[model samples]
Target: MTDLKHLFFSLGLEQLDLSEKEKNIINAFIEQSTPRFNDICHQRQDKEPLALLLGYMTQQHHIASSRWIEQQTAYHQMQSVFQSSVGTEHASKFINQDVDEYILITLLWLLVQGANKIDYSYANEQAETLLAHIHEETKESNDSKEDEQLRQRLMQAFYQGKKTTQQSLFTKLKRMFRLTQQQ
Candidate 1:
């Protein structure tokens, strides 16, 4: 699987650049704290907190389509945890190190997935779940003019890259033929 940075470069497309304000508030903190996160994740001491840090950074980035990216990434990280536990699948087992390595790998996946311009549908599904957690703040968040603007920005970024899901003409005809035969 492609690593996180590579995923971002390809999928995020126009969302990677941080603005001056974002640079001041979020980018600075991530730049300062990433090494600490890397250490914790590497050491296998506590991965959750580190994952949260990475998640927040991803959401705040200009993914253009979804702000819930951090949570989605988190979900994927958890899924990998399950995958590592059994060690009965197609994955390699590093003896006792499966959990940590898998979680870290999943975290990287989210990072790159944010930068991804493709796979908008998967992002959309995950974004909805994240929005639910902010349900109470929905009115307050969207009521503000600035928040409204951000919503639009996110929609553009995430939606622009989605491939339409229409069925092919041949498939439609085949289905219709089957239905007619049944009648």
Candidate 2:
């Protein structure tokens, strides 16, 4: 089982305390989304973008399914927690944004087209946005350099599978040509 705390930390909610109901909602979201996420990863063999996709999906599902009054309560509480943990300036980046709408659009796209058809570039952009927020909140001396390195690594990983497949194809073609010449 995936560790919820690790997932929350990746999502920039590490310091926040979730209510029992919120936890249950998150678990349900994970349960439902995991298969889709797995399928995408299996097809692409590129897991970077899809890493945060699950978290955004869970957040959207939770907000959309909750009653309005409950959502309001949870939103305010989350805002306060974020402000206190990361300071108001950084908190604003997470709380007062159209990110949720963007996430919803991505989710809608996924639902309509299915995970196997996901646009990796668009998904990577969303994942980078989420990581940027976390970088902003946790910035420190030399952290920008480290974060850039991390981003580069993620991008490399995203393309690595394709590179390997291309190399394999080239190798197979070379062997086949050599065999034809021998025959």
Candidate 3:
């Protein structure tokens, strides 16, 4: 075999490396792993309904616009790094982290917003209810108790129809998430 072909052949032997055939086989396996598009959330209306639910969360529990903006910046930076690590479309498949602070913040935002639309008596209920609404494929994150608590508190405020100063909320979330000052 030629040098290039030999290199590819050598790559096939390593656990981390793959020949084109093995790569194709793995790709096919992954494609088969997921349910069909029609079975998944492929319909526009179906997607919109969920978006509305999330929007409700944003409307109620999300902190001020400025903090979200900051989180967005952090999120985008992480997204860039993630993309570099594993291309654009495949990043979510290979390394599906929260995609940055924005995702967590957005989740927090939605929790605050959506939960607020309902009564506070149902906050835990709301949390559980929200859990049922999502797909099983979504991985639960491993966050600290403090981070979780602070966000829940913020969510309570949103449900209570209040917005505290950005500094205080940011401080709690930053500390909870272990976000650095540089970030």
Evaluated with TM-score, which candidate comes out highest? 2
In candidate 1 the C-alpha lDDT for residue 83 amounts to: 66
List ranges where model 2 is wrong by over 4 Å.
1-127, 133-142
Q: Tens digits of per-residue lDDT for model 2 on 28-144?
A: 656666676666556765565434454455455445434332345555677789989999999877653333333333333233222223456754564465446444433423466
| Model 3 stretches astray by more than 4 angstroms | 1-94, 97-117, 129-135, 139-160, 163-183
Per-model TM-score, in order, reads 0.32, 0.34, 0.23
- Displacement of the residue 73 alpha carbon in candidate 3, Å: 29
| Candidate 3 lDDT for residue 13 | 18
In Å, residue 84's CA in model 3 sits off its true spot by: 19
Find the 10 residues in a row with the least total lDDT in model 2: 108-117
TM accuracy, model 2: 0.34
Residue-pair clashes, model 2: 0
Q: Taking the tens digit of each residue's C-alpha lDDT, what string does model 3 give over 113-132?
A: 43224444555544433333
| Candidate 1 wrongly placed segments (more than 4 Å) | 1-19, 37-111, 114-118, 130-132, 138-149, 155-183
Distance from true location, Cα of 107 in model 3, Å? 5.1
Q: Give the C-alpha miss distance for residue 6 in model 2, angstroms.
A: 24
Score each candidate by Cα lDDT. Answer: 0.41, 0.48, 0.40
Ranking by TM-score: 2, 1, 3
